[model samples]
Target: MTAVQGLEGKMMNKYGYGTDYYGYRKKFVVLVPSTNTAVESEYHLMKPTGVALATRACVIPSIKVTNEEEFVGLVKAIGDATEQGLKDALSCEPDHVIFGYSAETFWDGKERSDREFKRYNDIAQAVGGCNITFGAQAIQDALACYPGVKKIAVISPYMPVGDNMVIKFLEDIGYEVTAIKGHCSPGAVEIAHEPFGKTRELVQAVNSADCDLILQAGTNLHFAELAGSLEAELGKPVLAINTITFWHALRTNGIPDRIKGFGSLLSEH
Candidate 1:
């Protein structure tokens, strides 16, 4: 061997690094509500190889659910907290940022939602100097997988106000919502504690042949695993917000690993 080959072989022989766990491809910064406990776990469950997820939480002190007024106030508070959380996440110098919360995604209508998304996008661009993913846009992209799907069954852990916002957004985007079943959970923390079995029941409650697909919102409800099973039984897509959001983040970053048991969006699309 030549002198350069001998030196390279000696260096290789003396030291070695183990296999890369994350492939060192891209780092993902995730933002969620402080009371949320499900986003991190679900994201990890479906995360593809070569991708790393780092999370930061927006503070939501308490949830007061007496009436619509309190609900509106809580949403505003969550929005404020999300802004701070986004700032914190951008400090990580991630390749991309993922918004793991869903309620704020649906505002008054499509125009308002688009404006809000642009605002968040601008902040992410300025701070992280990278692309960002939102749950609302992911859901819309997931729906595109089912070309003939015009009507859908919906389930959420939000109150009536939040549910209405979601419905309005979908309708404005040209999809008909056949039915929406809200758990009306007390607050963010409570929503995180919702049992997966209960979510399955909600799917059953809203599901019908009339609807083309089933969609579960509320990122903290833990529906990734259940979505796969429900899709098999119903013979249609059962998309959880977390699954689509993660899928979008990965695809937007050009990571196309097929993740199984989470639903077709990650596995097939």
Candidate 2:
């Protein structure tokens, strides 16, 4: 039998003993907007053996974003809903918390993102009694794995307003944006539906010889597998937001399984 099959049988043997799901070594409580459809699916695809992912939704009443103003407003609403989501996730008493949304991670600028992270961190500590991982902090940690990578190309499914915020945060952290391309996707659900072919085209459009790496932002884009493939073609690191977030969560919880075909962040570091 394969290793996974062996593990599965072992877990079944412990069923009568009242162990957690599959004798999971860790549990991650993920919080996402109600309109989001990608985070949970992607997380499930990449989750390693003995790790369980439990998701909670932050309620958002609508997803009809037509303009930059509406887009920004919707992102703010998602952020507002996270408080309730955090409370719900904490009830599960997970080993770690993961913010499964990305647009809000770039709101305002670095200062605002830091304040927001602190708010979420406090909530996780007080209620969940655990540390949390999110896009902004995860990206920062992922970038640190590649030394001397100063110039980067970016691709996202956000409007100009959101793009500016992402750029601001990167600049604040001392990285130069060589090129950036945004899909300007109409709504939350629509962003999740964006074709992987389009993402490939976006990466090609933004790629430059000066760019040390290519980074994809937007939790709904489903770029983890593609990022791994593209890294071979581009001869530089290609990072997806979900990969970074997952890698951060695993590392933070002291798990290092070296997941492959998802990017260097998981496979190498």
Best by TM-score: 2
Each candidate's TM vs. the true structure? 0.90, 0.93
What lDDT does candidate 2 reach at residue 98? 92
Instruction: Name the top lDDT candidate.
Output: 2
Per-candidate Cα lDDT values, in order, are 0.83, 0.87
lDDT tens readout by residue for model 1, 10-96: 466555443223435568988888878899999999876566788888888868566667777777887888777888889878888
Give the per-residue lDDT digits (tens) of candidate 2, residues 1-269: 34477468666685454334542578888888987878888888888778878888899875777899898888889978888888987987888899998889877777888899999899899887898997898889999999979999999998888888889989998899998999988888888888989989999999999999999999877788999999998899999999899899999998888989887889999
Q: How big is the positional error of residue 241 in model 1, measured in Å on the Cα after superposition?
A: 0.1
> Candidate 1's error at 124, in angstroms?
1.3
**RMSD of each predicted structure:** 5.4, 2.3
lDDT of 2: 0.87
Poorly placed runs, candidate 1 (over 4 Å): 1-23
